[model samples]
Target: MQAQIEILASLQTVDREIREQTGRKQRLLEDLRVTERQIQAKKGEIDALSAAWSEREKLRVEKDRVFQDEGKKAMDKRMRMSRIKNAKELQALQREIELMRLGNGELEEELIKIMQEIDAIRAQIQTKESEMAAMQEEWQKKQDELQVEINGIDAAVSEASTRRQTIASQVTGDLISRYELIFSRRGGTAVVEVAGGICQGCYMNVPPQLWNEIIRNEKVHLCPSCQRILFVKPATE
Candidate 1:
């Protein structure tokens, strides 16, 4: 029982290392996920700006078309003036032409404003695209580095698990199962030492009978307070 307890203790040590390594791997993976989300968010920003720029470009095209058609119509009206002979009719036609000219002048100003706005939106799109590219590049490097670290952790965990299995084989199946249960329940401490009639696991007093049994090393004992397996170091020559 004494030697068996020693084997269980060694098994617990390796199991603890495996648990810690697995936890570290999970944290690294979560960090990678967070960075990926940031990259996706950056892409969304660039897409929205591009859509807005496209809409403005469409508006500019329509405004320029209206400006061209209005100029053509005003020119056609001016050609009709040469064909008019009556004084009042000629004067009315001239006034109509003047109104069309003023309307075209207003449209020309609007077209200028639209062009300027399109230029501004294009500039914004360019800036956002550049920023997105840089973010993606940096993320790529970080992702590669994280993946390498995760792989290394995986290899280490695999090796530790093999070692734990070997140590566990030295312990009885019933005891191993019981210890695993306590280990999971007690936050990784399944086996503990008994010293001065006290359970080291919970720092509680051990019953006299249980303390004597622990010292005898004839059977496995448990700490009542923390429910951890108890052992005592045997005296050496």
Candidate 2:
């Protein structure tokens, strides 16, 4: 019975270690996913910026075409004014020319503003694209490294599991079941050493009588407060 209890304690220890490793693996996997999403979001931002720049370029080109057409129309009207002989016709033609010139000036200012905006947009797009590319490369490298780590941890977990199974096989079924029940209810720690007259699992002080019983090591003892199996460590040589 004593040997079986010791075996059960060892199995629980192995199971606890396995749980810790499994938690670490889960966290690493979550980190990998977050990195992937960050990379994807950066790429989407770059794409949206590029699209905006393209649209601005198209608008700038269209504005310049309209400005050129207005200028041409104004010049043609000016040429026609030279052939007019009547005073009334000449004055009216002059007025029309002035109005056309003012319209052209306004169009020119608007076109200049559009060109400046396009230049600014282009610069911004270039910066964002460069940043996105660098981030993607970094993310990919990190993901690959994590994948290698995950594979290594998976192999280790498998080995630990096998070791745990072997340890469990050495214990009686009743003791194994009892340990598992305690572990399930107490966060994977069923057995704890009684050190310095306290349960190491919960740091609770053991009663005088229970402490003495634990020191005998003749049978399995449980902490009344935390319900963890208690064992006494041998004195150091």
Residue-wise C-alpha lDDT for candidate 2, range 124-234, written one tens digit per residue:
878877887887788789888988998988898999999998998888657778788999999998988888898999999999999988777777788999998888766
Worst 10 residues of 1 by lDDT: 42-51
The lDDT of each candidate is 0.87, 0.85
Best candidate (score: lDDT): 1
Evaluated at residue 165, the lDDT of candidate 1 is 81
- What is the C-alpha local distance difference test score of candidate 1? 0.87
Instruction: Return model 1's CA RMSD, one decimal.
Output: 2.8
Identify the runs in model 1 with alpha carbons over 4 angstroms from their true place.
Answer: 195-213, 234-237
- lDDT by residue for model 1 (1-237), tens: 988888888998998998999999888889878878887887788788778878888988898899899899988989998998989999998999999999989999988887888788788878878887887788888889988998999999999988988888888759999989999999999999987888788999999988888898888888988889999877668
lDDT of 2 at 194: 86
lDDT score, candidate 2: 0.85
In candidate 2 the C-alpha lDDT for residue 72 amounts to 94
Question: TM-score for every candidate vs. truth?
Answer: 0.83, 0.83
